[model samples]
Target: MSDLQFDSSSAGIGEICKAIICLEIAANMKHVLFDRQTAIRLSGMSEKAYIRSFNVMQNGIGVKNTLDIKELAIQFGCVRLIPLVRKGLSLYRERFIASLPPSRRASADFTRPVFTATGFYLCAKKHKLKVNKNKLIELSGTSEDEFSSVSTSMKDLCHDVFGVSTEKKDPKSVKVNRDLLDVLPEKRQAEDGGYSSDEGKDV
Candidate 1:
């Protein structure tokens, strides 16, 4: 038992230790991965219940951690740690797209049946290669005129949002960017052998 120093140094040292511990915990959590089924097993909740509870928590907090398990499940599919992996990939993709010149950006907007990032994602998933204006409108639950009004925006998303290439064949025809489309993981697998050879290879 030596003489104890009742100074700010002790308090500062304690705070530093706490900060180091918090960072370690955060780093570990960021690497944790679980699928929807695994998450259910861990949380001991049914699918519906988990969704409901997650929604409540999300609403209450009004802020979200990028590593929140439930949010990752919803945004990046049910694949383990895929959302975390995608977070990095998305940042790189966003930076690349944002770096492009305005002339190449092709920013446009649809009015009725309002277009969104999700909308573009859905459209890409639904239409494989190419689609006409009317076909896109039908898929989007919008009137033909509304789709026509926002056609430029839709076209812009081809490169800006979706990273897909586009070609205007004529006044009524726009070719979907299959070159960029093939880069999708699912499509790549399907094109290769209907399965990724490296599937289940842990990141």
Candidate 2:
């Protein structure tokens, strides 16, 4: 055997097949865990592409009253990946609010809460609409007498845009949104379980 090249006979084929299967099963059972931040590295996409796409969607995509899911799906690579796109969006929104300097924190009034300022920023960013705080306040003409209603409106805004719970009395309460960062249901829900019109399955 030392003088000759050791070669596998036809009988060895069965053993080779078993080894390959064992490797694949082991890989499947391994804890292949990663977050959106690390998904691009783990997957086929390039690093440059992931960064560029993430930034454009977050800083540039307008939240104008319209929700465009197809456009988003294409940007993220596949329609099935909408859930992942939301992850990047959530981080962007959270970071934007967290960046505010001290003096800008919402005032004591609950209706005209200081976080309304952050909500305004989100509305502008999400809807592609430009809004100046002074203009909005002037438009609503928030008078002292209307504080209760204004505070209620502010609380609702807090829930929708920032996902932060307005019910909390704690000064240091964190802002968060319960839903994923996604387009309005109208634009997105209709596209669920997607197939093309060219290949219709529905009656």
Candidate 3:
């Protein structure tokens, strides 16, 4: 054998080799995707070594940055609702930014799990999909309290921006505001007559 020394532990030679092999296989076989076991076998790396390397890479890259809402939805067994979830996430982000003050808007950031849970909940509700709130919370890895708070904000956003009411209304108890009604005629008359209180005032 040729004289060669490799410090696999310190240099992460195994991980680098595994990654290169896996990438080459993926590039060559466009349609074929390898599972963890297959990838480990093909890479000639031990399972533990592969797992440790994956963890190191994942941690270095940052889990939050890599977190995917679509993957989370699949984990929650809502793969069929990905489109709705995406729409909800987009609208939620818009509404969230609009709600923040100019100064705070720049610093605005949401807890990822809570944010994802809220978006999923909102879209599921809007579409009348029967999703378990508890399951969503569990899958998102967020507490019930946190999810509830964010969900409340999302509901308000749906009502205010989309005109989709989240609360039940009692039509029987509805009463017209007579005072506001009495002011409508005068307001209409002023508009129609091109009349304004400031019209006669000199600038």
Candidate 4:
């Protein structure tokens, strides 16, 4: 892999999960895929190196390189993906918390707000489709890098996030948990009487 790339061939389970989730988010937005340019950017590699590592990642995850975008969305946006993604993220966060030397972890909570997997899942459910990361970041009032970090650590959770089947199911039967709604920040009015969060921002 090129120095810019993450060496997907040797990527740990967490990295794979992160890629899958990012790709899925891109698809669900209905306007983009992890297209060549974006993939190259994300991988931080030249075209040649990216293709090689892309093949490795696809082969490692048992997915085809030419996967249909619609099918990809349907597959990754489903309920099946939610639990695994959520679990993977939870595991990653646990590790993150554990790795912190007690003093920092305490302050980390408020200082470092994350766009979590559970939050992403809930956002997808809210629209009944995959969500756009831009909109999500805007809504959360968080930095893009912070959101990207959340998206990346998605794969760093557990091995179980991989090897999941993408078989389609009747989504109509699935019941959503209302408690998960807290992932979103509520709109608040500022002294100027404008929206305090992303509620009024263009998506």
Using lDDT as the measure, the top candidate is 3
Better of 1 and 4 by TM-score: 4
Candidate 2 structure quality by residue, lDDT tens digits, 4-71: 32121311223333333233223323412123223444434443333223222222323111223344
The local distance difference test score of model 1 is 0.34
Q: What Cα-based lDDT does every candidate model obtain?
A: 0.34, 0.32, 0.48, 0.39
lDDT of model 4 at position 78 = 57
Task: Return whichever of 1 and 2 wins on lDDT.
Answer: 1
RMSD values, in order shown = 20.2, 22.7, 22.1, 18.6
Q: Is candidate 1 or candidate 2 better by TM-score?
A: 1
Q: Report the C-alpha lDDT of model 1 over 86-107, residue by residue, as the tens digit.
A: 4433443344345455664454
TM for every model, in the order presented, reads 0.24, 0.19, 0.44, 0.30
Q: What is the full ranking by lDDT, best candidate first?
A: 3, 4, 1, 2
How many pairs of residues collide in each model? 1, 8, 0, 3
Candidate 4: clashing pairs of residues: 14-155, 14-156, 18-155
lDDT of 4 by residue, 1-203 (tens): 12243444344324644464346434533534334445456655544444333333433444322222233235455554555445544654555565555765654331122334224544354445665655444333333544444443432322234212343323223232211112222212223364333331211
Q: How far is candidate 1 from the true structure (C-alpha RMSD, Å)?
A: 20.2
Candidate 1: deviation at residue 123, Å?
1.3
lDDT of 4 at 41: 60
Top TM-score hit: 3
Of 3 and 4, the candidate ahead on TM-score is 3
Count residue pairs with overlapping backbones in model 3. 0
